[model samples]
Target: MIDALHTHRPRIVVIGGGTGLPVILKNLKNRHVDIAAIVTVADDGGSSGILRNYINVVPPGDIRNVMVALSDLPQLELDLFQYRFKSSDQFFAGHAIGNLIIAALSEKRGGIFDAVQILSKMMKVDGHIYPAANEPLELNAEFSDGTQMSGESEITAAGKLIKRVWVETNDDSHKPEAVQQVVDAIMNADQIVLGPGSLFTSILPNLMIENVGDALKRTTADIVYICNIMTQKGETENFTEADHVRVLNQHLGMNFINTVLVNMKEVPPAYIDHKKWNEVSQPVKHDFAGLRAMGCRVISADFLELKDRGAFHNGQEVADELLNLIGRSPDEE
Candidate 1:
């Protein structure tokens, strides 16, 4: 067994946003690795969209969730932070307490990046959380039919087959940039994890940033993608594991990923409640040969979990796979 005390904490950089990012982080926090999560800022939906439009602040909804995931706060405190105002409450309807706190701090501290840092210290977050970019980004997607749409929500709602997606300023002028810390984290990481989130919206939005993508390509760290178990409607309706990696490679113009963690257990048909799990409604078809052709060291396992009848990753299992990778040298892998 590896001695927890004497061994250096392996530096891990997780790049993605959306619900799945937090699930993995929640599990990883209990382990010894030093984690830094780089979250996408291209969101334009729900409370995040409302807040971003009203204040031009980096959408705090995703960041807030990531913070709570890594926080060592008491259950009651976390509940209070996650509490959302009722729709009947006209002024604060649909706003999470943590979202408001983050937005307020963003204003007081000059940006969301600083707001997250201040909040991290207060919340006793187990790892670093950095927004993919300091400014609000607009996600732009071109459909396989050669038409395009902007905004994360719009791109998904458009529902066409996405040929590719990229990020730009909300105004379509200046290119968004990540802070130095974000770059440094990627460059120095022992392992890099990409998604278990929306392929185009949650994961790629972060990489769409010129510097972040460039850093990912240049980094010597082992790039491991946690492939999602299900296919998302409007985004990845019929995507295979290889298709996911293919799009990622096409976007960055290089196949830098070293490994892929995929689910071996199959999600049962008629098991998913479409009303609740409408976004990602089907199991992702496996393509082992294709993945091998892409030069990925694939680690397939029974990584499925059912919550409220909805399929999700078994976070503990996935984190174990990541930890095992951290233990092995490139030659051994």
Candidate 2:
């Protein structure tokens, strides 16, 4: 809402976390779109997990990446911010400078939301970066075997078929809440994007928030889901395009998505280096008929980009398609 000059441009709210969210945001930052990112805070892994444990702050890894993606800072400054301490530094090993800064800012500002907003200004971010909820969230999941697990890392490590996922705070009495800005962004957006990340851990954790889910359900914007290029081992091992959509609808208790961006380019058999891509199992299967049956307007293209023997969404191509979709509103049609 602070971005007054771009008021005339299409407003987009991109929601999710992990490496994928940043890729999409980087692609969209230069475009003439008004962008706001709602990132997940359920992470309990890596440098973020360490800092969160020690400082009692919301996980900063996803938020840091998202901020960098939208930032207009010079390459060297950004690199310095992203720099991690060496393994030899026992006290600060593996912590990104940006994560530490965010942790300190969170303490100073009294919460993660304001810390990010202030940093957005400091970093000259081209878009708004809002944590999905103000507080740190714990992701809990129920697997098909009728077993339950807590923590994002543990759930993925279990490698069990997930039945459902939800979020809560460590303090049982205090429920996590989305800030007013996040709700307003979703409600007023011209286009809303979900995923290209882990369906359960990265994306669903945000939507499971009550206010966020309500905003998604009531928003007038055309909701679009960017399905992942590959199946995540513990998340969606054999998921088809429709299966991805089905999980979203199931979680939200509504068929809210209007369109699905699917990758049409096939991955050559034995092409992906599994050792390099530890989390990926295989290319996501296509189910055009299934997607149509669920009332989705499917947009299939060669949205794939293979690099270092790994599959990913071509960010520029995906961003262009999103712009084209948002441009032709129902009223215009």
Candidate 3:
């Protein structure tokens, strides 16, 4: 809870990709805080991957979703943009109109970074949306069994315990880097939020960017990680909330995550439809002691929202708590 009503709008830089990032952004659109979402571009799956393979452009699916979440356009117009073609359509099958539009813009503008900025204005996006990198990068991960694989989808499907993950260009090249705006946004923000997404595939891909990770570590902003409600099957199987944080810190080489927002509400066992929410394995167990020992201030609350027979974060509640954290006391947790 906010100790006092805040008059000034605080700057918040949210970093991650996948479906979960949008939930928080959608709710924050109504709040008083300024938002800058830095989404991962390492995705190599679905329509985005298909488009990337053919066009040689950055995956626009994540950024496209982020655009919709922050867009202030008309519902009808946004709906039209988000419409996906039926697989039976043959020619344009399995592709969303928005993804195609973003890809076309990326080609016209010469890169995904500028393409997103141009699209942001036309979409009337409420906040800044940035791709983690300018190019279509490959996600490479080494498993606990000493096996390695590339591509986001492949890693998860491998069903192997990911030891660590990183990004690279299509060919052997220099390190992947975030645009100046992405780095600057992190450095200037009062708060930085991570996750509510896949642990390794979605969240780690963005942070693995050399410049982005450096900014996260060097930035003085209070970094808060919104812990996922459930462990993912291939990625975070039987993992606790603290285990998630532990991986992030290990990757970054420091205890930079100052706070974590964990869901206290329980999801009924019978309610989960495994077929629908296939990625979900089980409810993420809490480790308040572990988190506290790592110097992270833990805020455990009923942030769960059961939807479509699966557990998810209550975005409004999570956004409200994030707002309350701006310039507030750690002791408040």
Best by lDDT: 2
- TM-score each candidate: 0.96, 0.96, 0.96
Candidates in order have lDDT scores of 0.89, 0.92, 0.90
Instruction: Please provide, for model 3 over 1-333, each residue's C-alpha lDDT reduced to its tens digit, 9 standing for 90 to 100.
Output: 133324446789998999999999998885767899999999989999999999998998999899999999999999998999999999999999999999999999999999999999999999899899999999999999999998899999998898999899888578888889999999988899998899898899999998899999999899999999999988999888889999999999999999999999888999999999999979998899999989999998999999899999988888889877885432232
Tens digit of lDDT per residue, candidate 1, span 246-309? 9899899988888999999978877888888779768899999998898999999999998887
Displacement of the residue 61 alpha carbon in candidate 2, Å: 0.4
Q: Quick one: RMSD of model 2?
A: 3.5
Cα lDDT over the full model 3: 0.90
Q: Which stretches of candidate 2 lie over 4 Å from their true place?
A: 1-7, 328-333
**Residue 292 Cα positional deviation in candidate 2, in Å, after optimal superposition:** 1.1
TM-score between model 2 and native:
0.96
Number of residue pairs clashing in candidate 1, backbone atoms closer than 3 angstroms, sequence gap of 3 or more or interchain: 0
Cα lDDT, model 1, residue 215: 98
In model 3, the worst 10-residue window by lDDT is: 1-10
Q: List the residue pairs that clash in candidate 1.
A: none
Tens digits of per-residue lDDT for model 2 on 18-67? 99999999988867778999999999999999988988899999999999
